[model samples]
Structure formats: structure tokens, C-alpha cells
Target: MRLSRAFQPTLKEVPSEAQIASHRLMLRAGLIRQTAAGIYAWLPAGLRVLRNIARIVREEQDAIGAQEVLMPTIQSADLWRRSGRYDAYGPEMLRLKDRHERELLYGPTNEEMITDLFGGAVKSYRELPQVLYQIQWKFRDEVRPRFGVMRGREFFMKDAYTFDADYEGAVKSYRRMMLAYLRTFQRLGVRAVPMVADTGPIGGNLSHEFLILAPTGESGVFYDAALEEQDWLSEPVDIDDSASLAAFFDKVTHFYAATDEKHDEAAWAEVPEGRRREGRGIEVGHIFYFGTKYSESMGISVSGPDGAPLYPEMGSYGIGVSRLVGAIIEASHDEAGLIWPDAVAPYKAAILNLKPGDSATDAVCERLYAAGAEIFLYDDRAERAGVKFNDADLMGHPWQMIVGPRGAKDGTVELKRRATGERFELSVEDALAKVLGA
Candidate 1:
């Protein structure tokens, strides 16, 4: 995408309202704009990063056999009433009334609605195990929504629901999802520790919150450092095998990890002093095995093997697709600007034309742009070299292909790695190879 043609409205100074690094940089870098308090309109650049995150979330969900489905943002209040939560959910539910005077509410979550949908169609143990997921917008009337998308009132989220015929099967589903969540975060280039957490309104005895460590996080967390060493994806756990899934879950839970809300002094004392890690953490994802909470409340019953009526055990898994954008920035930015990891960067690399219209510079940039047009953000704006450089750093592309007049004349470009601030002057061919990781 060409900067000149893009609608990125980057700002020079930080907005006073942005209190956090992610919030300030998101505004200064032109990733998002506040349309209302606690709400934002994702600009083109921001949307690209969001879509990339969602894509990764979707791929990981699919790999775990979850089927994608679209659920409505506006849910019928009747659904919540059926689940006995209409009055219990509080004002954050966004209650409203349609023109017909019928009660309605924007869904903060979809447990009730999904239960009703599947309850009506799925009957019998034959349809015992299923996982349905959707990447959609959700709104919660946060009294004070700060930290940009990190705590936005309106944000995109990936929520998946799993249904199983029995408690044992539900446990299996939960373990599989735990594995998927760890792998997803790893691929996104962030270390999110899975910590035991409260279920809250979701109502489950077993729950885990994946928290990414950052200095500016919302809450303090305590965990064993060993949890950071496991590569979940490489572990030989077959999701189809319940025993394997249980073993994997045991392996992970064997480590001491908990947010401050659930921290246990006795357990903390058990850890070796050197392995103890305490830091601020921002929650990026959560999973809960609610068992029959939704199914029982909604009167969802399927036939058991003995032909007896049975309530399908349920679990819900969520990854903050939009909040991740802010979380990534919070966890990875430097003084210059954001430092996006290669896996989730909006653009893999950017071609910065130091002299946009200079014939030599233009030729070199055009050639580099042609080599990787699909994955490159070409800065063809008629801006100063410093302006281009600063903006490239602010946007945080994993690599910057700097095309200055001198290098352009020699058919060479300078490759700058965003994460390390390392620069290498190389011929156009070598630059292309390096950027492509060939």
C-alpha cells in the first residue's frame, strides 16, 4: 500500500487523553481514532493489523477443529432471560428497546444465544462434541474505558463455544483449547502465561486467563519461570486423544501460575526463589469450562447413549482480537515507536522512498515494491527523509527498506530491522532476499 494513497492520519504529538504507551502510539501512529469515549474507528492501517490478528486466531481455532460461524451483535433479551441472566448481567449488558417496544440488548457475550441455537438443532449423543467460533464485535458499557483498544467498550473478539455430551468430554475439549490458545499466542510472538483465574459471570469452576507481561499492565501476576520454556505446539499431544490432552494439561498446570486475584501464598512459597517471576500482566485471552451452566439453564437436552435426556457440558474460549493490537504494542514497543513482531505486523516490510520523486530513488523503490508488493507498505509520499524514517518506525513494520538517493544510484538499499535497530547496506537483490527471509 502506498502511503500517499493510504488514509493513515498520523499525529506528531501524543494525544493528552492517551494514558498508556499503546494508546499514545496508536494515536500518534495513525492506527486508530476515537469516535466516542471508549470507542474507536479503526483506520486502514489499524484494520490491517486487526485482520492479521484475527486471521491468526481463526487459523488456530480451525486447527483445533472449531467451525467458524457468525453471531449477531444485537441479541434478543429473551435469550438472556431464558438463561436466567437478564437481570443478573447488570448495566454493562447494553439494554435497549426496539421500535416495537420489545426488549433487546447488545450481547456482551454469547453463551445464552449459542446455547439456544444449538439446543434447538442438535439432539442425541451423536452430535455430542462440537466447537463453534466467531470473530465479531462486542460492546460492554465500561464506566471508564481507557488504554485504547486494550479496554475499549467496543472491540473485536474471537469467542468459541464447545459442547460435549459428558463431563469427561468437556474436560477434553477444555484441554485442547488450552493447548490451542498457547500455540496461538506463541505464533503471535508474545509470551502469554496461562494463569488460573476466576470464572466471574461466565460461571465455571475451571478457568484460565492468558496474560501477556508488560510493565504497564493492569494487574500484577505471579508465576514460575518454567512456564515460559514450553513450546506447546511442538508437544506431542493429539487433540483427538483424551488421555494425551489430559497429560498435556497436567504438564502445564504442574507449574505455579496465577494472577494476583487468585495468588496463593502457600503455592508461591513452594516455588524455588530463583524461578519466581512477578510482574504486571495484561489479559489477552480467557477460557472456561462451564459444564452444564448454559445447557441446563436453557433446557438444552440431548439423548445419551442410554437414551436418557442429558445436558451437554459447555465451555467458552475467547481471545481478544482487537485488544491484542494494543497488548502487542504495550509488550513490544520502544522509545522511537511501536516495535511490531514479524508474525503479526500489518506489513512484513516497508519500502521507504527517502526521495519520493527523485528518479534514482523512485526507480529503486519501485523495483523493491514490485518484488514484494503484496506484503510491502511502500512509502511513496513526498516527505522528507526524516519524516519517512520516523513514520516507518512509528508504524513498526518488521523491516524497513530504506531507498536513499546514494543507495538508489548504486542499485542498493539499506535494510533496517525494527526490533533491534540494526541496519545493513546491501545490493537490491540481497535486500530482497533478506526481507523475504530467503
Candidate 2:
């Protein structure tokens, strides 16, 4: 993408209202714009990042055997009524009325709706275990929606519901999701710790909130430092093997980890003095196992192996798809701007044309852009070298290819790593190999 033609409306001065780093940088980097309080219109650059995050979430979900399904944003109030949460959900629920004067709402979550849908279709123990997920927009009428997308009223979310015929099955489903969340956050380039958390509204005895460490976060987190060093993807987890899943869950939970709501001094005291870690963290994902909560409330029942009516045990797993954009910045950005993880960066690298029209520089940049056009954002704008450098840092592509007249004349370009400011001057082919993986 050429900067001259791109719709990135980057700002020079920080917006006064942006209280957090992600909010401030998101505005300055031209990723998103506020259309109203607690709501935003994701600009082209912002949408690209959002899509990238969603894609990773989708892949991880698919890897765990969760089938994707698109659910409606607008839901019938009657569904909530059946689940006995119509009046209980409170003001956050965006209630409305349609043309026929029927009670409606922009769904905050899909527990009841998914339960009803699956309940009607699957009738026996044979269809006992299934995970359905969707990446979609959700709205909650936050009384004070601030901090940009981090606390937006309207945002994108990935919500998955699991249906199982028995308590044992639900536990396996929960562990599978826990493993999936760990892998998802690891790939998103944030060390998100799974802490025992309060089941606010989700109504689950067993719940975990995946919180990423950040100085500016709202939640106080306490955990063993060992959790940060875990490479969850390195471990082979067989979702079909209950014993394997149980062992994986036990291995992780054995660590002393809890949010402020669940913190135990007794447990914390048992940890080695040097291993105990404390910090503020932002919650990016949550998993819950609320057995028969929706199924029983909504009268959703299936036949058991013994031919008796059974209420399916259920769980809901959620990843803040849009909020992650901001949370990632909160967890990963530096003074300059966002240092995007390669997996979720809108573009893998940027080609900075220090002299856009210089014959030699243009030739090198054109070759570089052509060689990795799919993964490169070509900065062909007629901007000053300093301006291109600042913008490239602000946008935070993982790699930056600098093409200047001196290097271009010699058929060479400078490759810079965005995260560490590491630089190398090499031939065009070498630069391409470094950025494009040969």
C-alpha cells in the first residue's frame, strides 16, 4: 500500500482525551477515529489490524476443532426472558423496540441464543460435544466508555459456546478452550496470564480471565513468574485425550495466580519470594464453565444414553477481538508508537522511499515492493526522510526497508528491525530474503 494513496490520517499532536497509551497512539497513528462516546469507526489501518487479530483468533479456534458460525448482532429479548436474564442484565444491555413493538436488543453475549439454537438441533448424547464460535460486533451501553477501543461501547468480539452432555465433557471443553486461549495470546505477542477471576454475570463457578501485563492496566494481578516463561504451543495437547487435557490444566493451575478478587495471601506466601510477581494487567479474554445455566433456564434438553432427558452442560469462551488491538498496544508499545507483533501487524514491513522520485532510489524501492508486495507497505509519499522515519516508527511495522540515494545507487538498502532498532545494510536480494523469508 502506498502512503500517498492510503487513508491513514495520522495526527502530529496527541489527542487530549486519550488517557491511555493505546488510545493516544491509535489516534496519532491514524488507526481509528471516534464517531461517538465509547464508539469508533475503524479506519482502514485500524480495520486491517483488527482483521489480522481476528484471523489469528479464528485459526486458533479452528485448530481446537471449534466450528465457526455467524450469529446476529440484534437478538430477541424473548431469548433473554426465557433464560431469566431479561430483567437481570441491567442497563448495559442495549434494549430497544422494533416496528412491531417487540422487545429487542443488541446482544452483549450469545449464551442464551446459542443454547437455544443448538438445543433445537441436537437431540441426543451422540451430538453431545460441539463448539461453535463467531467473530462479530457487540454493543454494551457503558455508562462511561473511555480509553478508546479498550473500553468502547461498540466493539468486535470472538465468542464461542460449548455444549456437552455431562459435567465431565464440560470440563474437557473448558480445558480445551483454556489451552486455545493460551496459544492465541502467545501468538498475539503478549504474555497473558490466566488468573482465577470472578464470574461477573457469566455465572460460572469455574472461570479464568486472561490478563496481559501493562503498567496502565486496571486490574491488579498476582502470579508466579514462571507462567510468563511457558511456551504453550510447544506442548502437544490432545483435546481428545481427557487425561492429557487434565494434566495440562493441572500443570498451569498449580501456579499461584489470581486477580485481586481471588487473591489469597496464604497461597501467595507459599510461592518463592523471588518467583512472586505482581503487576497491573488488562483482561483480553475469558473462559467459563457454567453447567446447565442456560440449558436448564431455557428448557433445553436432550436424551441421555439411558433415554432420560438431560440438560447439556455449557461453557462460553470470549476473546476481546477489537479490544485486543488496544490491549496489545498497552502491553507492547514504546514511547515512539506501537511495536506490533509480526503475527498481528497489518503489514509485516514498510518500504521507506527516502527519495521517492530519485531514479535509483525509486528503482530499488519498486523492486523491494514488487518482491514482497503482499507483506509490505510502500511509503512512496513525497514526505521528508525524517517524516517517513517517524511515521514508520509510529505505525510499527516489524521490519522497515530504507531505500536512500546512496544505498540505492550502490544497489543496497538498509533493513531495520522495528522492535530493537537493529539495522543492516545489504543487497536488494538480501534485504528481500530477510523480510520475505527467501
Candidate 3:
């Protein structure tokens, strides 16, 4: 996309309200704007990154046999009442009344609603092991929403629900989701550690919070250093095989990991000081195995092989699609600005026209843009070379190709890597080949 035509309202100075690196960079890059206290309007650039993260989540979910089905943002409060959670959910739930005086709410989570939906159509054990997922906006009116999207009241999330006939079946489904979450985060270039966590209002005995360690994060975590070295992507994961899944689960669970709510003092003391890691972490994903919590409360039952009515076991998995943008910045950014992972970067590379009016610089940028590469061309007429350089670094594209009259005259362009601050002089053709190949 050409900067000349793009609606990038980049700021000259950091906003005083942004307390975190991600918040400040997001504002400066024009990726998002605050619509209210904790609600935001995602601009074009931010939407691109959001969609990329969503795509990775969807692909990983699909890989583990989960099917996608969107649910409504506004749901009937009657469903929560049926699950006996209407009164228990507290003030965070955005409760309201429609014109007809019927109760309604912007769903903070979808356990009760999904249970009702599943119960209405799925009766027999034939559909016992089905998983449904959706990527949608969720609202939770935080009393003090801060850290930009990291703790926003209104945000995008991917939530998946799994239904199984019995305990054993449900456990297998939960393991599949765990593997999928690991893979999803790995592909997004974040090292997320799965730590045992409190189920909170979701109400499940078995739960895990996938956390990415960052100094500015909200949640305190304790973990084994070995967890930082495991390569989940290299291992073969067979979701359908219970034994294989069980083995994988055992291997991962062997590591000592827990969030503050579930932290075991004795267990943490057992580890050597060097091997023990204690830090703040961002909760990017969470999964729960809630057994019959939702199914029994909402009358979701399936017939067993013996012709007996039984409540289906249930599980829920979630990834904070919008919060991940902030988490990524927190974990990856430097002094200049945000350092985006290539998988979720809005543009793979940026073409900086150091001399916009020069024929040589324009020709080089035009060829690169016309070659069908996903690039952002800095062709703004009024911007100076220094301003363009600073903007390119701040925008955090993987590669910044600087085209100038001098470089073009010498049949070369300066290619800079945003993450490493490494620069290389290459012919225009070589630069295109290297970046496109990457």
C-alpha cells in the first residue's frame, strides 16, 4: 500500500495516557485509536495484523478437528440464568434490558449459550466429539482497563467449545486443544508457556493459561527454565490417538509451571535458583475442562451406548486475538518502536523513497511495488528523508528498502532489518530476490 493514499495518522509525540510500549507504539503507528475508556477502533493496519493472528488461530484449530461457527456478541440473559451464573458473574458482565423489558447482555464468554445451542440440535452420541469455535468481539467492563488492548474492556477473541460424551473423551479433546494452542503461539513467534491456572468464574478444575513472559505483564508466574527450550513444533502431534496425546501431555506437564493463583511454594522451592524463573507474564490464551458444568446446568444431554441419558462433558479454549497485538509488542519491541513478527506483520517490507521526486528512486520503488510483493511504499511528497527513515523503523516492517538517487545511480539500495538494525547494500534485483525469498 502507498503511504500517500493510506490513512495512517501517525503521531509526532507519545500520548501521555499510554503507559506501555505497545500502547505508545500502536498510537504512533496509527494502528488503533481509543473509542472510549477501553474500547478501540482498529484502523486498517491494525485490522490486518488482527486478521493474520485470527487466521493462525483458525488454521491451528482446524488442524485439530475443530469447526468454525460464529456466535453473537449480544446474547439472551436467559441462557446465563439457565446455567445459574447470571447472579454469580458479577459487575464485569455488561447487563442490559431491551425495549421489550427483556434482559440482555453483551457476552463476556459463551459457555452457557454454546451449551444451549449444542443441546438443541445434538442429541445422540453420534455427534459426541464435536468442537465448535468462533472469532468474535467480547465485552467485559473492566473497572480499570489499562495497558491498551492488553486489558481492554472490548476486544476480539477466539473461543472454542468442545463437547464429548464422557470424562475420558473430554480429556482427549482438551489435550488436542492444548497442542493446538502451543502450535498457534509458536507460529506467531511468541514463546508461550502453559501454566496451571485458576478457572476463575469459568469454573473448571482443569485449566491452563498460556502465558508469554514480559516484564510489564500483569500476571505473576513461576516456571521451570526447561520450558523455555522445548520445541513444540518439531514434535509430531496426533490428536486422534489418545495414547500419543497422553504421552505428549505428560511430557509437557513434567515441567513445573503455575500462575500466581495456583503457585505451589514447596514445588517452586524444589527447583535450583538458576532453573527457577519468576516473572510477570501476559495471558494470551486459556483452556478449560469443565466436565458437566455447562451441560448439566443447561440440560445438555446425550444418550449413552447403554441407552441411558448422560450429561456431555464440556471444555472451552480461548485466545485473546486483540490482546496478542499488545503482548507481541511488549515481548518484541525495542527503543525505536514495535518489532512485529513476520507472520502477523501488516506488511512484509517497506519501500522508503528517500528522494520521492527523483526519477531513479521513483523507478526503483515502482518496480518493487509492481512485482506483487506485499509492501508499504513511503512516497509521501512532503516528508523528509530523516522523517521517512524514522517512520519506517517505527512502523516495524521486517525489511526497509531505502531508495535514493545516490544508491540508485550506483545500482544499489540500502536494505535494513528492523529487528536487528542490520543494513546491507544490494542491487535492486538482489534486494528483491532476498526479501521475496524470505
Query: lDDT per prediction?
Result: 0.90, 0.91, 0.89
What residue runs in model 2 are displaced by over 4 Å at the alpha carbon?
200-205
Poorest 10 consecutive residues by lDDT, candidate 1: 197-206
TM values, all candidates: 0.97, 0.97, 0.97
**What is candidate 2's CA lDDT for residue 132?**
98
Candidate 1: regions farther than 4 A off: 201-205
42-118: candidate 3 lDDT, tens digit per residue = 99899999999999999999999898988899999889999898998899999999999999999999998888888
Question: Residue 37 CA error for candidate 3 (Å)?
Answer: 0.6
Could you say which candidate leads in lDDT? 2
RMSD per model, one decimal = 1.5, 1.4, 1.4
lDDT score of residue 231 within candidate 2: 62
Off by over 4 Å in 3: 201-205
Instruction: Write down the TM-score for model 1.
Output: 0.97
lDDT of 1 by residue, 274-392 (tens): 99999899999999888888898889999999999999989999999999999999999988999998888878998998876789999999998899888999999888888998999
> In model 2, what are the clashing residue pairs, if there are any?
none
Q: What count of clashes does model 2 give?
A: 0
